[model samples]
Target: MADPQPARRPGGRTARVRGAVHRAVTELLAEKAPDEVTIAAVAERSGVHQATLYRRWGTMTGLVEDVVAEVLNRGSPIPDTGSLRGDLSAFAVNAAAGLASPMGTVYLRAIALGVGPAEGAPDGGHPGFDARAQQLQEMLDRATARGEPVPTLPDLLEVVLAPMYFRALLLKQPPDEEQAHAVVDRLLALTRG
Candidate 1:
């Protein structure tokens, strides 16, 4: 079991507990799937009581959501490079890199599993699928504000993102500058098409 007490940080007690729990869950994810991971594992890893894990996150999904939310929050920092092309290229590069990362892929796959079905994904008609499409739309809105006219969000995602994820996950290839440029150019063409 981990220490009964949590870290004593300047951010105060809640911060300390949250940090410990986050670390514990992160380490657990390194070794196991999110579905297989348990609250007891986190509690033992953190040296905190099982009650603490239950009280804090309530359930495995809750804890996983917290971790995912944190990951997304940090991952999608606004990319403002004055020009929409520059901003999108930067976003593509970052997205490519993230899809190739261990933590990022896991969260993505987990989220996919939570959705209704795979077949419904391509059409964006899944009952409970959450592709974070809103974030992409927000990016479009920001671009529009910058004088760029972007049509549907899926077109952007399919042309710019599909290839990145396809290569990163399916092809088992690393995300490189060449791939990022390819996606960006394709997306740029789509904007005109």
Candidate 2:
């Protein structure tokens, strides 16, 4: 008879280590600048070995990218309000609120500074951007499935996301709910034309 395969543990040691490391990174980012947070500091704070961090994330940028992705994903889930306008409006408001937070500001700065190339980018593109793009695409796909008119990704980026990001990251003024809704309305209007 063939040997039985070992059972996988979802919340195993590997998961614990990653959780500790991620928590450490987030705390450090809250207290200090991205450049000030280092592998040694994270190792000491997380109680995980420096070698383990290096083995898992490759570099500070890699670690930051993972943290940013996690933060965004957890903070702003895709809404399903049964309409494209409702979804985008909720998404925009949530996104704006996240960006307006202290941690969000830190994340925006890290992204703006171009931490490093993403894991699979051949030309050194930002992974955070890629993650957001995937999120937007998912939302668009849902809208399309519902027989709703959807703007192209570029149009969404330019009309909806760009303005919010510009106001938050560049202008240091995150949009309020009214402004966010206006941005969504503007994007929806584009689809009508």
Candidate 3:
């Protein structure tokens, strides 16, 4: 039979441990490459034991995955500016700014490497793509609730977002303010058409 689940502890030692671990992971990612951020290193930095990290996260990949998820959720919050265009433009600008940052580049590279070639990924795409897409869908859902005419998911991801990632990853050019707005305009036109 499976072992019993651990006892619950709300906002207690469990929370502190998780916070310390996450904070250590974030600081390490800012300073070092993803591969270099080992469990031992995190343990040393956070004062948490290596055994605890292994037991809680299973491995470095698991820890990094959770770290990236928290970063994405906290980093790319959906802005509500009382209009769809304003919201989309804000989102695009924020995304561009992140890609332009040194630590963001490192984090994204780590995410890409970790996700690539993972089993069951659609079309061998990034493993985190689904989660990212879900975040975008939630943003779109908010816009829809405000009576905005949003494009289909395929159109939003493939047509609209594809260019942004291409510029950041392939061209090595993260969009400036004008370029970000232009992307939003292009998407607006496509959705309108």
Candidate 4:
């Protein structure tokens, strides 16, 4: 078996402290607002010391931002399938698969708290929720490689992601192979109409 990502350590103690704070605080914010966040709580959840949380984060806002980075960075990259339909099916399955677990549902709900109905990213900027969106968007890029123009990314989201997530998050349904493949089927039907 090969490691999908090679583990690399930062050379500095400062970087280590930063990483610890980021992980700890993000875990804390998984269910609560930054104001409700406490150093003791972060320490208890992350196994880091209260001193470290205080020294590194300096303030609640700092802690919150660092944790936000960690949360946004936690997602794995989406797969590429060389066609909008195939790639979206893969993306839908991948995204929905995670939403099936309790931890996954909790994380999804936590993120939803921070995200309002908006365009672009969860952060309200165009950078768009770290690389997960880009990885997902790559599925559309695959269409161009096959001589078809990739549709608008949001439109792609509506057709592929909307249903998958809605079912998984709101209905507590796990996406099966049939349901995953239906994303592709639905998109194809819509496009042909």
Which one is best on lDDT?
2
How many clashes in candidate 2? 0
Instruction: Judge candidate 1 at residue 140 and give its lDDT.
Output: 82
TM-score of 1: 0.72
Clashing pairs in 1: 2-47, 3-47
Across residues 97-137, which tens digit of lDDT does each residue of candidate 3 receive? Answer: 77678756755665665664542235643334556677778
lDDT of each: 0.69, 0.77, 0.72, 0.60
lDDT of 1 at 106: 66
lDDT of 1 by residue, 127-181 (tens): 2223456666777888788787675777877888778767766787867777898
Q: Write the per-residue lDDT of candidate 4 for residues 1-193, one digit (tens) a residue.
A: 0111235455566566666656665556656664566777777776777886677556454455444445446656666655666667766676666666544554555455445443223444322254556765666666767877456677666877677777776787766667778876877777656
| Model 4 lDDT at residue 21 | 59
Candidate 4 backbone collisions, by pair: none
Question: What is the Cα-based TM-score of model 3?
Answer: 0.75
TM-scores of all predicted structures = 0.72, 0.80, 0.75, 0.64
lDDT of 2 by residue, 44-101 (tens): 9999999988887887767777766666556556778888998898888887777778
lDDT of 4 at 44: 79
By lDDT, the better pick of 1 and 4 is 1
Instruction: Give one clash count per candidate, in the order shown.
Output: 2, 0, 0, 0
Clashes of 1: 2
